[model samples]
Target: MKYSISWLLLLLFLPFAASAQTENPVYDEIAPFNEGLAAVRVGNQWGFINENAQMVIDFRDDLVWNQDADTSIPGVLGIRYPQFKNGRCMIQKLKVNNIPFYGFIDTSGEIVIQPEYLNITEFDQENAIGIYVREMYQGQNEIKLDIVEYIFTEVVVNINGEIVWPIMEREHALTAKRRYEVPKLRAKLIGKDLLEFKTEDNKWSVKKLNLNL
Candidate 1:
């Protein structure tokens, strides 16, 4: 009687395969659906996976989140939550790479906005504001505190590289007191879809306003 080697091999490996399956079966926890997909945490990284447990966006980062439509697109006016929009998601890249920079990435994981800004704030009034700061030091001792002067400035930018508005020299200082006494500049979204900045000095100005809503 000739013994079939292939059958014998299959029988010998079957128990090992069954044991492997029993010990290492894949376990999946469903992720919450957002914008037609969901982000899942696998091991230590987070990525977007579809309902079928297939990876839509591979896990590559320490953290991840979704962005909604208003937050993803440029020029939409209104507050947007921290999530992805229009295939672009905001993420914090490497922290040790320098100043913690926040930028947007497409679904393909391409960075649309390079991480270069110092800080990215929550969407406010239809715009996400980025802040960059320059710090100056003044050696003011207790005896000669009034003699020393310190100045600080903050530059704000939008995703489109537009300077929506700037808080000038003295006004940039967080502790500044009445540095520029110019009347409070009031920003109003006017009828023509323009931002009308009116000052008490009768200086009427107009700029296109990006409404996120």
Candidate 2:
């Protein structure tokens, strides 16, 4: 019997790989490790696991996907996949207005940003911005929500839920432009206080942030 170096390497690695596969014969799907954790799918729900093969995050509820608005839930996102970056990751939930919205979560599994937007950007250790449905209160202390009622606009917000810059829209720039120093674009912090955005003209716009973490 004979074997090539590659074959020998494969032989050496197979046991460990097989062991891992056998040990966690639970999850139906899994993702790459980020922040020392990996997202895994079991049944329809998803959760995270530690490097040492510990199921650190339990798969509780399934992340619902692209449905129409529910007109009930406060927030929702249709994303079923997520990866950790800069200690935070994006996730989605069930139908709100029967549709999904985007939000952020920390490595510790805390919902730092409520899933209130159809789009969102990853945080760069300090700030982020997203297009969200403006929350409204109506009579009877109820949350009034309808996509058509409010225009989608971008605004500067942090993990602490503080709005640094006022909201901005694409079509009506002059008003938002006057209220805010600059119009909000599809923007995220690429570096310290540095943001890169895609303008309505599809041009790249860079702005320096003047807010604190």
Candidate No. with top lDDT: 2
- Runs in model 2 with CA error above 4 Å? 1-23, 61-80, 137-148, 170-185, 200-202
lDDT of 2 by residue, 1-213 (tens): 356887998999999999988886676778779779888887667788889978776675634332253323222232335556577677766433344566777767788777766555555575666676564444442465432334567777676656676445644322222253222345656676676777768788888777753
Q: CA lDDT, every prediction?
A: 0.48, 0.61
Q: TM-scores for all candidates?
A: 0.43, 0.61
Minimum summed lDDT over a 10-residue window in model 1 is located at 73-82
lDDT of 1 at 137: 51
The 10-residue segment of model 2 with minimum total lDDT is 71-80
| Residue 39, candidate 1: alpha-carbon lDDT | 60
Deviation in angstroms for 68 in model 1?
21
Model 2, TM vs. native:
0.61
